[model samples]
Target chain A: MLVIGELINGMYQNVGKAIKTKDKSIIQKLAKDQTKAGASMLDVNTGPASAQPKDAIKWLVETIQEVVDTPLALDSTKADVIEEGLKLVKGKAMINSTSADDDKLNTLIPMAKKYNAQLIGLAMDKKGIPRDRNQRSELALKIVSACMEQGFPLEDLYIDPVVLPVNVAQAQGVEVLESIREFKLLSDPSPKTVVGLSNVSQGTKNRSLINRTFLIMAVGYGLTGAIVDPLDKELMDGLITAELLLNKNIYCDSYLDAYKKK
Target chain B: MAVDLLKEKWQNKVGTITIGATKAEGGTRASTVTVGGQSTLPFMFGEGDMPNKPVIAMEIFDIIPEEWPATLKEPFKDVMNDPAKWAKKCVDEHKAELICIKLQGTHFDFGNRSDADAAAAVNAVLEAVSVPLIILGTGDEEKDNKVLAKVSEVSKGQKCLIGDATDKNYKTLAASCLADGHSIIAESPIDINIAKQVNILISDMGLPQERIAINPTIGALGYGMEYAYSIMERARLAALNGDKMLSMPFVCFVGQEAWRAKEAKGPQSEHEDWGPESTRGPLWEFMTATCMLQAGGDILIMRHPKAVEETRKYIANLMK
Candidate 1:
């Protein structure tokens, strides 16, 4: 699984305060923590708490880069902020993300090309996250089609099925998984599938348990990447064991340690 | 009419490691055998490169194997008493590509031979064969650590594939193999994860991944062979998909595992409908081995001469 650590976002109190006060230690520590916890890339988002997302995004990128050299995922609703983070990324960056809407696609696709970065396309539109599998597939195909039309490689695209909180939308969990499987069948060189893995358990008790169960099911349905809290050892262990049983990883007695080392 | 055929281009190739260093390279072997480096599934001719054809290494024990069925023991009856002559017969008479010297006598439960005895037996076989050698321990962790290290010491710089290092007792054997410039076999009990972890551990000890092979533990044709087959298939697929830790070539104990099955070695009088044990035993061995080869086995340790010949001929034709 391509783990994009979801901790560096500016929504959490420490991150929000860190962005405001320019306290590099808090952000840098999270960066080092996530990287050490098996995150291939760290998602940098100036979440709703940020008053100036563009500046915060750039600062987060620069601050994290100062410590570790892991790849960054620039997350924002505004293309300009994402573009700001992209400019400062020392290595490859991921745009997290674009919706199926034409405006987001037109802006982010060009920015993605300009930055030479992978893209995360949400299975959503101006109307909002789809309620059913067909609508999810429709939005997914739109994102895939836009990527193709823009000459962006589908292999570089990660189509996210926009997971919702399972407590309220339990029926949609099945829809999201089915959408993930269908997303792979969208093109010859398929757009990789990702999920905002934490979204499934938002505002729920046993959040980690719910997220772990859903993530394993999603992987079975061809989910390739995930936006997750890498520091969550239990969740990470579940994924490691799942991938091992799926034969995605070779087994060893110390596989838990081996997975972390790799 | 022109036809378009489908093909896959894999990102990783199985690692190739040569056994038996020549005199110039530090060993006295006449020739070396290199296996692995396949870029596609076995027999997928037009798809990718099979850089080296899979080779067969016939197993010769330091001490005569008493429990081997009469069918298996028949060919080696004359030479089994001497490891050197037995190894020579396997090479000269049977056209074996490599000789796998099993130090069966060193096992604590077996003869419990001394380390010096084990070293002498290994030296005797090394002196007798021009072909490459695969030096296997007796499969007891404690005895293997002591004896394999000794065998490795005596055969230093010979580039033998020293083997069966598990997750528990790998450090000793891995360190020994690394010191002597020989390759190591990372053994897992038919589990792909353990197979990869053993490789990682060996590599972690500074022995390069290129100098390792995975033994996922073979099962006979009727005896959980599908489990072994699937494990091999999955390991090969992961290797081709660019999983670096899994890209090492695989070794399956075809002769030992196949002969253990009653269908292959049991007397024909016990079950009349199963046909004569003469052709039945060798055929059982051949079928199991060929299936394993198709699943991307790089080096097969086999026993029966007829099975070895048939498998070699089949490999020659398929590789062509």
Candidate 2:
């Protein structure tokens, strides 16, 4: 599992205050802690709190780099804010996302190519998240096709089926899983599949349980990466065990420890 | 125009395991044997790498066998009663690379010897052979738990490959191997899922993956050999395709299974067209070993000296 820590985003109270106050300590500590908790890449979002969002994204990216070497995921709705963070990353960065819309694809794919960043493509347009998996697959294919046309490597592209809160859109969970499986055939080398995992459990009482169960189901359908709370031990353990049973990892007594190291 | 070379690129390879610690590495053995680090199928040089050659270990028992045919027993008749002498004969005379000591004497159906006797036999063999040892416990589950644990403790750090731990009963033996720093042989009843599950179970008990091998219970020649081959082929393929739990080198007990076949032991009078029993028995064992090697067997345990010699020659030639 390519765990992208979802905790460092500016939506959280501590992160919002830190992003406003330009508090480097809080953001740096979260970066180090998330990396130690098994975040291969940290998702950096400036959220609605940042008045100067472009500068805040750069600050988050630079502040994270000073403490940990983990790659950054430049996250924002605005192209310039993402580009600001993308410019500062020393290593291969991830563009945390673009939608299937032509405008988003036109801007982000070129930007991803310029920065050599991995692009996460959500299967939705201005019409909103698709009601069925077929529409999702079609939108996901558009994203893959755009990357191919632009000469961006499909291996560096990730397709998100746009997971919804299961408490309301229960049937869409199945559609998302089917979309994950279908997304593999969009190209030869295949765009890796990822999901913002916490969305499935949003507004639910058993948040951890729902997130882990859905995560394993996604993994079974060949979802390669996930935006998740790496600090959630139960969720991480479930993911590690799921991969082990799928024969993706070599079994050792301390597989939980092993997966953390991996 | 230049032709592109045909090659296969696998994501993973079998785990390489070293058996028996040398004197410098904290054991008394003169040498150690390493097996199972192949990125490709057996002997497929063009596709990938088979880093280590398949090796053979001749089988001996704690007590002299009562079921051996005259043709099979002729080589080691002189040293039959003494376990240490029997192992020495295997290594000294036949140039055996590894010795597998079966604690058959401790079985309830056998003499029901004490665990102390089993430990003593292992000690004698460790003293007798400079090469690595593979100690196997008898299938008597209750007795094996008691006997193999003592044997594992007595031969601590010798790095002997001790096993026959299965899915049903493995905790005691796995813990013993972990405590004593010995490698283990996990046996599955010719099922790939069970094979993987057995590995996971043992691994869950604290033993590392490299210190384990899979004993996919084999079928002798003319008796479900193809079935055994298919299972091993799938396992090897899974391993190459990056399934880590199934990637341990295979350990096939060829001699014990082959000798049980009527083709290897039946008298000529029973089948008029069949060749002399003397050569037929060893040939059966050799053919079975050959089949296993092609199916990616890493350590083949055989009984006949002539068959072991032939397999060694074949392995040497195959490596070249």
C-alpha displacement of A145 in model 2, angstroms? 3.5
- All candidates' lDDT scores? 0.90, 0.91
On a 0 to 100 scale, what is the lDDT of residue A206 in model 2? 96
What would you estimate as the lDDT of candidate 1? Answer: 0.90
- Candidate 2 stretches with Cα past 4 Å from truth are A1-5, A14-95, A98-118, A124-142, A149-151, A164-185, A200-225, A228-262, B1-8
* Model 2, span A1-262: residue lDDT tens: 6899998888999999999998999999999998998888999999887899998998888889999999999889999999999889999999989999999999999999999999999999999879999999999999999999999999899999999998899999999999999999888988999999999999999999999999999999999999999989988889989998997765555567655533
Q: lDDT per residue, candidate 1, B235-255, as tens digits?
A: 888878867788889888999
Q: What clash pairs does model 2 have?
A: none
- Candidate 1: tens digits of C-alpha lDDT, residues A1-262: 8999999877898899999999999999999999999899999988897888888888889899999999999989888888988999999889999999999999999889989999999989989778899998899899999988999988789988889998899899999998888877889998898888999999998999999999989888888999999999999999989998897776667777777655
Q: Is the docking of candidate 1 incorrect, acceptable, medium or high quality?
A: acceptable
Residue-wise lDDT of candidate 2 within B1-320, one digit each (tens)?
A: 99997677887899988999998888899999999999999999888888889889989999989888888888889898999999999999899899999999998878999999999999999998899999998887899999999999999989999988998999999999999999999998888878878887887788888999999989999999999999999989878986677889999999999999999998788888998999999999999999999999999999999999999999999999
DockQ of model 1, rounded to 2 decimals: 0.32
